[model samples]
Target: MTPMIPMIPTSTTIPLLDAMLADPARAQAPLGDGPARARTGVAVASFIDGLRCFDAGPTAMIARVEALAPEAQLFAWEGVGLAAEARGQIDVALAAAPTFAPLLLVGAGWADALRGRKIGAPRCAHVDRWSVLDGQGFCLGLLDRRAALLEFAPEPTVALAIDQGIGRSLYFVHGGTASAIERAIMDVPASRRGALWSGVGLASVITNGLNDTARADLRERGGADLQLGEHLAALLLARISTPPHEPPTGWAATVLDGSEPPIAVLRRGLDRG
Candidate 1:
């Protein structure tokens, strides 16, 4: 009888193995991002879904994620982001991505999560970096309210990512209502409001978190940003495209206006008023 051993980073014969010797954020850079925006978008859509496993051990969580189709595996990775961040050891997840979760990376929204710094990000995930930031934003909202409101991303796009993440967080943290979200958003600076609104739009549609009437409430509160949130969810839905057609078969077609972006569309309106 024989047993196989896990390959260490020192393995000279394998590139991915060699990659492990590099920094965690880029350990999978050798694999390229594999259509990064799509990857990040799917990660955001399912990130919350994976959070259910926050208390599970990594091996148990990885098993569940492994059973999913390849494109769907981000469910586990994004969960790793949340669990690691909550413990204040954010980079630990990427430091040793399991072999299956190839191409691990982090970005602006991840390190200094509440602060939204562009730390530890590799160029491979320029746009993908935004989604992790969104994930981190969720962490901030759920875990640290003071930091969530006090810190803000300065760059327009970076601000958009951080704000959107926060917006998504509000849906989970505050009672998942439009009115509550509106009141909570008041805490965000006015300049960041659009992206934050877009994020609520994202959370509602992506997770099917809100009902029709409540969604309408969000629409009024979210406005163009709400429509953008739905559109971004639709756009990423196309990227993930799981069976049962997530959010109903025609839902994506109804919301998608046009032009999926290089980054997750922090701005999309789905032709609604």
Candidate 2:
């Protein structure tokens, strides 16, 4: 069994948590009910914690992040990358290497490419670093939807990553209205929508508790690719040290019945020495 991730210590995390809790609306994502609400809140807090704790050093940051619930630590790691980039401390974190392998793994997997440029390895068993770009896309979509929606870009990989991020933010930022989210997606360039759909799949199953009608509508709009996205996110949840908070009424209920993902697979890509 995965160990429990305790609440972060007060010196570094409490103020950050309090500030984030106070401004929950700033991100515009509704805090739903039950497991989904709690999990979503945890991700936000962990992200905020990541931003706050980074200055203390990677070792300090890792200790605090590990204190969070195991299922939500990935976002905390993502926050650390955001903090490192904002502070120009990328190299500092990367050099920590095997000692900070978990953060490096998530950072490489779920961070933006600018950060990836600094980290030579992802430290994953089978995971790739593509989602790092997707993380940037989420920020753009949530903070600047116009730019995110209108990217006909030179690099398809980066463009798709942005598209996926926008799709993810759309699920949270838009009111839980399927038609509105669907329309926003449909309004974007067609080639980009698939990536967006994948991000939506990530949000729906990963956080859970999107209303049934809205969830069904989005899935219908997504067509064949939606399930692919959902399954991948489910598999990712399996990689967490703990079970994801996916609920029966939520979209991932059916897929999670099989098996937990093997996170140890991540170690094969790294050299502890």
Give the whole-model CA lDDT for all candidates, comma-separated. 0.50, 0.54
Q: How accurate is candidate 2 locally (lDDT)?
A: 0.54
Model 2 spans with C-alpha error above 4 angstroms: 1-42, 91-129, 151-154, 211-214, 240-273
- Top candidate on lDDT is 2
Where in model 1 is the C-alpha error above 4 Å? Answer: 1-63, 66-77, 80-127, 151-153, 243-273
What TM-score would each prediction reach against the true structure? Answer: 0.55, 0.62
lDDT of 2 at 135: 57
Please provide, for model 2 over 1-273, each residue's C-alpha lDDT reduced to its tens digit, 9 standing for 90 to 100: 322222333332233324443574543354323324455666666676666666566566677777877656666676666555444445555554233333433443333333323222232232434444455556556655766676434155346545666677777666444566777888876777776777777777766746677577778888655665676676665544343353433333323322222111221212231
Per-residue lDDT of 6-119 in model 1, one digit per residue for the tens?
222233232432233333333222111211224334544444334333334445555655666565554445544544444443344443343312112222244345344342
lDDT of 1 at 240: 44
State each model's C-alpha RMSD to the native. 11.9, 10.1
